[model samples]
Target: MAEARSFLQRNRIHRALSRSNLLLGGDRELVLLTALAAAILIFVVLTVYSALLGISIWIGILGALRWMAKADPLMRQVYTRHINYRHHYAPTSSPWRRP
Candidate 1:
């Protein structure tokens, strides 16, 4: 059973690596969008059953925004602009700062 499990894990990793290579070799924008979508999907799915419905809903909303950004250039531009501005304006303090 352990051997079989290891084999399955290896196969999954191989397939994921191959798919990642294909995505990386193609259009960079598509790869970024795909990665964002996958991350949001995983977050929602993982949190759906936990006592974190609010967090899951927030992630789902962001995922919807990401999807819309993919369809609308203006949305993408606004989203990135705000993100850059936030990072620029925020102070870079110590890593272990308490609230």
Candidate 2:
């Protein structure tokens, strides 16, 4: 029993350390700011949600922000495809004709 518990605890710690490392390896400032915003939003949702409409709007905004962050890679992929297509398919004609 004790051995199993120790293994679980170690696994959790390892996972957390790996996640932290991954975040730190990227844009650390953006990660930290997003984390701060998420924490604040959670606190507000827990303590300040008196009306349904306002709470729903705040939650929607938070969801949209999260979606945008996750969608960045997809956006980059689309942009890359656009550039590749332009390079491969652009017209070869010269604007200045030879005399």
Best by lDDT: 1
What is the TM-score (0 to 1) of candidate 1? 0.25
Q: What's the lDDT for candidate 2?
A: 0.52
Q: Please report the candidate that would top TM-score against the real structure.
A: 2
Q: Against the unseen true structure, what C-alpha lDDT does each candidate score?
A: 0.54, 0.52
Model 1, C-alpha of 66: deviation from truth (Å): 0.4
> Candidate 2 residues 7-48, lDDT tens each?
343333566544422243333444466566656666677655
With candidate 1 superimposed using the best TM-score fit, by how many Å does residue 49's alpha carbon deviate from the native? 9.8
- lDDT at position 95, candidate 1: 55
Per-residue lDDT of 31-62 in model 1, one digit per residue for the tens? 46655665676666776553265446545655
Position 26, candidate 1: lDDT: 36
Cα RMSD for predicted model 1: 18.5
